[model samples]
Target: MSLDLAWRLLKGGGRKGLLSTWLTLGAVAVSTALLLFAVAVNFAFTARGERGAWRNPVPAASGAVAVEAARFDYVGDKEITVVDLAALKGDAPAPPGLPRFPAPGEVWLSPALAELAGELPADQLAGRYPDPKGVLGDEALVHPGELVAVVGHKADSPVMTAARSQDWIVGKGPVEVASLAGTPSEDSEAYRALTLVASVLMVVPLLVFGGAAARLTVARRDQRLAALRLIGATPGQVVRMTVAEAVIVALAGALLGAAVYAAAAPLLAGIAIGGGPWFVSDVLPGPLVLAVVLVAVPLLVGLSAVAGLRRVVVSPLGVAKRETPPAMRFVRVLALLAALAVFPLLSRGSSVGIVAVALGLAFLCVNLAGPWVVGLIGRVTAGTARKPARLLAGRRLVDDPRAAWRTVSGVALTGFVAGFLGLLSPSAFGDGQESAQLRIAAPVEQAEAVAGQARDRLREAGVTATVRVSKEERGQNRLVAVALGSHAGTPTVDRARTALAGLVPGHTPTTQADDQRFGLQLLADVRVGTIVVLSVSFLVAVASSGITAMSSILDRRQTYGLLRLAGTPLEVLDRARRAETLIPLSVMGGGAILTGVFCALPFMAGGVSTAGLVTLVTCVVAGFAGVIGAGALSRPLLRSVTADPAPRPD
Candidate 1:
């Protein structure tokens, strides 16, 4: 409990201890920083979304109305059904005297829709703005020359006339229509998806740092703890002391992390929203309160105490001598089994599959096979090495495979998560179908003519198109079709639609088809980002593992020194250690890859193909190689341990 004694003990572990502590701190720092950013962004966006909803709620009749339109081609296919505003109003319909339909050639525009189209150029606009005729192509429902009125729904003001002019062409319709309602208050699907991604990313580094800290606390301090026991210190006292040290370190790291997050919150918010705080209110203090309670405090306290507390309760004498309790092994076994069982459930087609695989692999590699793998690899490599330095490296690895593997595991897990998440970039999904807009003419005969012309034009452009027709209540119409082609730029479906519209003398086509160019661009960006993040994360993991392993090697200096005196060259010793680590790394790496891919198979099967499988395999191989290379590089650390003639008692 003496400050002087604790400081001296802390300083005595030499370079190994110093390096290990720094590594732990660095890992903790990086993990906490990234986690903070992710959490902050998530909260900021969520808050903005919520406020945007409150400021612009959907009108009572907003959900009921829909626009019905035909396909772009002469085949007269049905495309989309715009929301039905009439049904939504029900008993509270617009003044009873109000016309049920807009006067022929005239239409109503919602304030939200008006704002969206306000900036569009008149020449570029294809048809009347905001009218059901423009949106649903219902020519009969609209009267010619009737005044177009812009009505505000769910806004502070009832009606604010927009400065933008309407583009009401006599024959064709607008290419797309804006929704009468504002963005939805809640997108549960998107929230759940982001949460899954964020949780996986956050937990990876937490486990790495926590495990490393725990191992270091128990491993590096064993000799000192053993010496204290010899001086009549009780096991409980030693354990308590170790726990106290961990508490101090965890607390310091956590508090520093939280402070860093708070100071950078503004910057973080900007990144999340893509500009200045968009939905934030200066008058409201609730977000600030929520940030602290929901994000900062819990992260610090939970990460700081979880690992260290467990390590502290163990008997120092036993721990120092490397006599970890049998229960720990049992726990490891149970964890491995649990991970194995959960792997299939995760891989079979859920977003949570990635997290399950990451966690499962961490448990198996770091907690279960670490020591055994390190020792086995070290021993085998030592047998083959001719160089004295290399042999010593092997022996160092073999002498304490567990510590070596622990280092490898930490780095490997970090890399795996980074790579996996990087590869599945959100952009890779492309703007889903939700964002695309499709529009067509109203009259069945006109729609059919437009569809045929579109088909002919697309065929000339070397695209194949199929169109289906359908009718709605009281003469509403639509067209649906899938187009195929090998054009390099825009999707063939979109190109065909455009060409078809041009062929119709007086009609224009409006539809949301795949934008091949945009899709490709998004894919490319995601691929690049994934590669970069994965590579950097992997390298960091590798370096941390090697350093930690070398530190472990140094801790067993006396043991290695005795082995040397017993005619074991430093080369053989180091080789043994390398062999021990290699086996587990390979096993765990393979297992992780298989498990991850297996878990992702169900979801990926629908979209990703054999190519994605290859990509994943490549990632795993690169990750494994990086870890092994790091272990190999730690040989120099072993050379520093002097070979002494005296033998030490086991």
Candidate 2:
């Protein structure tokens, strides 16, 4: 009986109620889709990590099946992962992505590398390896376009024991491996941590938006539910009816959202991170995660809907008389303060898990304090009002701060995200060494001999350069340097690198950019990630502000109508509406930004960079513009509601 009544009411709310229902559904859809996309990033990184782990072989103490060594090689600017392997026993299992262990003089390249090799000249790239005997399988590569080569060599090859100048640069020397199973690389782990952090930044805002969906059209729903109570509907009946209505709409929305994400997964695979774009499979949160989202979103929405009924359930008479609820407590602000205080203390050198928890708590605390700050702003606005619109706006704020907060909360939280990432975004490192220098590491005893070879190679290649052997603190060996002339550039660098490729046995010749390539790539990725995070945050902010603004008008249509009938000008009502959002948004948005900056301070080793300052200012300007634009878009709705002053059954 309750379910039947719920259905009737849901279908009978006329056009405005129907519009509210569709708006709520759309909000849920947006929230669910964004949530899935955010979660997919962590999973994608994990997949990439696992796929590439076999390259970092774990040594076996005894009964070893194969000997393996891996190093990074470059063609132009592209990085190629080269793995050399030799079999100790006939039954040695092939490393991942091969039909069988390669025979001596045989080389296998990934599909991408094979294609690349065909396009480049033999001396530049393909000549570095034996002619390709086969293409590597997907299991041997991290992403679809990864460059990898597996070359079979004699066990006694000099490459096996060549000195690895740096573990990160030259890769580890050959080790006897029993199995291909290995752990994720340090770079992979770092990326995973970063993706997780990005998820939290995105997901928290998505959740807050989702919860706000349940409260859409609260005033009208509360009135109808309260009247039912006043006419003898049991509390259980009311609760059941509310749950049925909210959960059903939410479930439909959740399913639609999951479909949207699934459809967009192929497109999302193109977002480059950690060296390359993703495989389609990597970007999908699997069926288990999909099931969880479909179930959990509706449950959350239902609970939030029920929680908003305290007034309707506890005091129907008061709701009927349209009395204001008590102001939110100051404790909410303290909660935010406490969260901000704890973050810096826990941030430095703490594990990723700890930092994540602190950030999550801080993110949620921003949401918690937003309404209380809005209430305070309302009180101040009302006390200082000097005009009709100001008085109306102030009265609205004091009357229902939570509603006003909902309209601006997305922007406030985005401000927090912007400030946090903006402060940590990296700037370009100093430009050092004007001349291009190519270098290779050699044993201290062999340094002079390698230096002699380097000079000869550069001369034969017609490259203008000076050669020297120098010792750096980072390595135990001496480095043979080929310092090129002022006019030397990419083609000269490549020729020089190829000429000296085998000069040092294990270590490849490296340019200054190659020496610092990993660090530079990491910095570049951070900047890209910052842009992505901020872009998504702004989108959510705009959607929430716009949708909630329109919903607020729908929720308060009767009030706007009454005001119009009482001779309030349309211009005054519109000004009041804008002031209601603008006042609290300024206060809460600024506060959230400060809180975010405070949280990020512990990581600011050299203080804020110029790029960071620019990001902050840009976010502030964009955020204000987005919110104000959302308000402007809803002005027509405001005008429409006031155009008809008479009340309807809905």
Candidate 3:
């Protein structure tokens, strides 16, 4: 019977009511889709970590089946991950992506590496490794374009010896492995951690947007429920009806959102992070996650819808009389202040889960403080207003601060995102082409012999480089520096490095430029990721503001009609609407931005960057522009709502 009544009430809502329903659903859909995308990052990185885990071999306790060592090699500007393997027994299990254990002298290259090897001269790129017998399967590579190679050698090979490893490099030492399964490398873990942080930055806003959907047509819902309360309806029944309506719409929206995410997964896979684009399969949130989102979203929307009914449930008369609620207290601001205060005190070395939770808490606190700040801004606006529009706008704000906050909350939260990410400037590592010197570490015993061999190799490869041998300490390995001539370029550097590859049994020749590339790539990725995150955030902000603006018109049409009947000009009401949004938006958005900047202070020990400053300025301007544009789009709706200033039956 309740479901039947809920359905009737839904259908009884006229065109305007139905529009509100649709808008609520759309808001849910967008929020759900964005939420799924945010969560996908955690899963994608985890998958990548797993796929690449074999290269980060774990040492066997006693029953060792194989010996392995891994190192990063460079071909021009590109980094190649090289893993050398030697089987202890014929029955040793083949690593992931290999059909069987590699025999001595066998080599396998990932497709990208094979392609690269084919494109370059044999001596420049391919000479270091034996010709590839086969390509590595997808399971062995983190991404499709990852450059990786696996080489097989005899157990007695020097490359598989403990002496071939460097203490500073993770997974570089040869370890006897019972099996290829291992943990993610530090590099992979760093990427996962970063993705987790980025997800927090994204997910909080999405959750807010989802919750806000339930309150889309709050005025209308309150009025309808108040009417039922006066007509002998029980609060429980009214709550059930509200929940039924909100959950029904939300469930539909959530399903739609899941569908949308599924469709966009392929496109989203194109976004490059951690030096490569994700595999499409990696970015997919599996069936369980999708189901969880669908169920959770509707429950959230229903609960949010019910929570707003306190006034109606307790005193329908007050809601019907449209009395101004008590003004919000100053204490609301304390949550945000407390969050910001604790954020910096937490050490950078705190666990990732702890930091992520702190960030999420701080993010939510911004929302908690938003409405109170909006009320204050309204009071100031009303006290200082010289015009009727501004005065009306201010009074409306004081009357319903939560509604006003809802209208501006999207952009205000966006301000937090902008300020937090905008100030993050990746450290400047200069362009990698400045240096032409290649450095290789060689045993002191073989320094002269390697230097002579290096000169011969360079000469034979038609490369002009002067070889110098130096040592920083008495017992340390000798350093072989190949200073390339002025005319030497990428090809020349590659040839020089290749010619000297075997000069040291386990060490790869590297340039200062080569070492800086990792930092450069990481920073570049951060910048790009910042742009993508901000763009998505702004889109949500704009969409939320626009949809909520129109919904606000539906909510207030009767009041608008009465005002029109009292000779209030439509232009004044329109201006008031604009003022109501812009005034609170300015206060709350600016405060949120500052709060975000405060939260970012600990991470900014290196100081601000020019790019970061520029990002902040751009965000401020763009945020304001987006809100204004959303307000403008709703003007026609306002005009329509007040077209006939006559009260009508539902």
Candidate 4:
């Protein structure tokens, strides 16, 4: 019997039931898939790192030798003493066989060292070699100075060429030697942090899509559940039947979504790296996990539906009558009080101020004022609506005021979060002004010359700039820092820096921008796009719920007619409908906004501000008014009650 009844309900609901269920399933599927994809990427990266595939290759001898210096001076008159190969190995090669110490008064160079020497003239290169005794332990190579010649793994040799050098050395013995011990790859803390952030981002799309579907399903079917009760079905049976139907729909949608994600996984991976092609073996494990999420998401959504069924069951009578209590009054009051108390803290630059203001405004607009606003608009607009459709809408709002607010809450919350966070994060905007120390790459010998040239160029361009040269702690590379005028735009700064970087003799220059600007821009884009999506979703839900509610009301027109004949005025009947809408709208709007605010508080406490608060509130209120106005104008459908003279005997 239950199966038969469930089937009947599914068939009756048809497209509407199927759409709502699939939408919910899609939400879950998308969210879970993303989570899975992230996991897979992490796994792939870990596996790659374990293999030591991404490391620099060096000769085996270098790994065994450790050169140390006392009180190492990077820029001062300190020197590196290289250990003798024979001493380190405890074995000496025959005199005539291996050329020891680069044929006396000479030095052996690594591929990197050879490349640096090649950059200078042959005459200049002679002086560039470090004192042979200072580096090697034996002064014999330096004392004789027998035409000091440096022997290195050949520069043009296939395996020993420098990374930055274009030329290669030919005719080489033992072109490259493998290091005796491989260095372990270092773990990236940043990558781990990004993975966590990506995982968190996955939740947003899930909640957004799933919550939207759930709310729409409940709103649209309230009247249907009420009718079921009137026809001798228990509320429990009605709730169970609805849940069963939702589960079926969700499962089908989830399966479909999974299939889509699996097929598209490769494409998504390719896009991740600037749309470059990637091999199947290189594909991250994340997409595969997303495929699994497809099924799991549907099941979870089904569970969520079951959780919400109680609300539909206990209120069938109220559903038919369009009655329910306003939502979150106490919570809203608390939010407002918290907002007031925290206002002072904000003035003191306490980060908590952002949270207090965001919560207070969200509560005031979404919860407290939402229903009343809907009701007022419905009443005022009902009289002005000339079209039958418009009049019918107005009348519906007048009958059930709370329902209007429920429809607008989802979109409002999405907008609020986006706007609030986007404005404060500097990286979100691409301004990149947060780093304390700057590094510029250039040749050691030409470091000062490059700085001077950069200063001259900037001055010629009517921009003041400061330049400083410093050596790296390891004495590996010379660095230059250029401080441009405060008024320089990012593009200007970038251009100037790029031009100046070219003047540096043998070093590549790279710039790091502030992270805050990137974050802010990302948030802003999300806010605008999500709001549009929310708006469309809300409109669909409202239209579906409103039509369903109106149909039920029309079915009971005779009841309304009899009440009118029994001396109830049209105004009172209108108030009753308005009150019905008021209840649901208030509950949904208040709950949604309060929940949104509560969720956003932690982010605000972290640094998001309240400048966008008024805008968010205004948008929410406007949306509510528009929805209510449409409902109020729907009143002409109720004209049938006044048109008929006699009441039907029930």
In terms of lDDT, the poorest run of 10 residues in model 3 is 162-171
lDDT of 2 by residue, 531-645 (tens): 8888888888888999999999998999999888889999999999999999998988898898888888887766788888898899999999999999999999898888789
- Write the residue-wise lDDT of candidate 3 on 310-391 in tens digits: 9899998788888777777777788878878887686667788887888899889888888888888888899999999999
The lDDT per prediction is 0.45, 0.85, 0.86, 0.44
Could you tell which candidate, 1 or 2, scores higher by lDDT?
A: 2
Instruction: Give the winner by lDDT.
Output: 3
Question: Cα deviation in Å at residue 428, candidate 4?
Answer: 10
**Candidate 1 TM-score to native:** 0.59
Q: Write the per-residue lDDT of candidate 4 for residues 1-650, one digit (tens) a residue.
A: 65577768766755535544444555444444444454455554444333322121233444322111001000011111121121123222211112442333344543323443455433223233444322221121211111212222222332222122111111111212232122322222333333343333333433444433444446556667668777888866876776666666666655664566567667654532211223334444554565566555655665666665565576666766657533423454455456445433443233333544444454344434544555665766677766544465566556554445444433444443333333333222444443322345555666688678777866765555677886552144466777665665544454453354325322223334422322443454445433433443344334433443444344456667876787766766666565445444554545555455454444453354344455456545655665566457547656655567496442
TM-score of 3: 0.97
Predict model 2's lDDT versus the native: 0.85
lDDT of 1 by residue, 481-585 (tens): 333423322343344444554343223344333223234434544454345345545545665566566666656767677777778866677665665555556
Name the runs in model 2 displaced over 4 angstroms. 428-435, 459-464
After superposition, the stretches of candidate 1 with alpha carbons farther than 4 Å from their true spots are 1-8, 11-20, 51-188, 255-335, 342-401, 411-475, 479-540, 560-583, 607-611, 621-625, 628-650
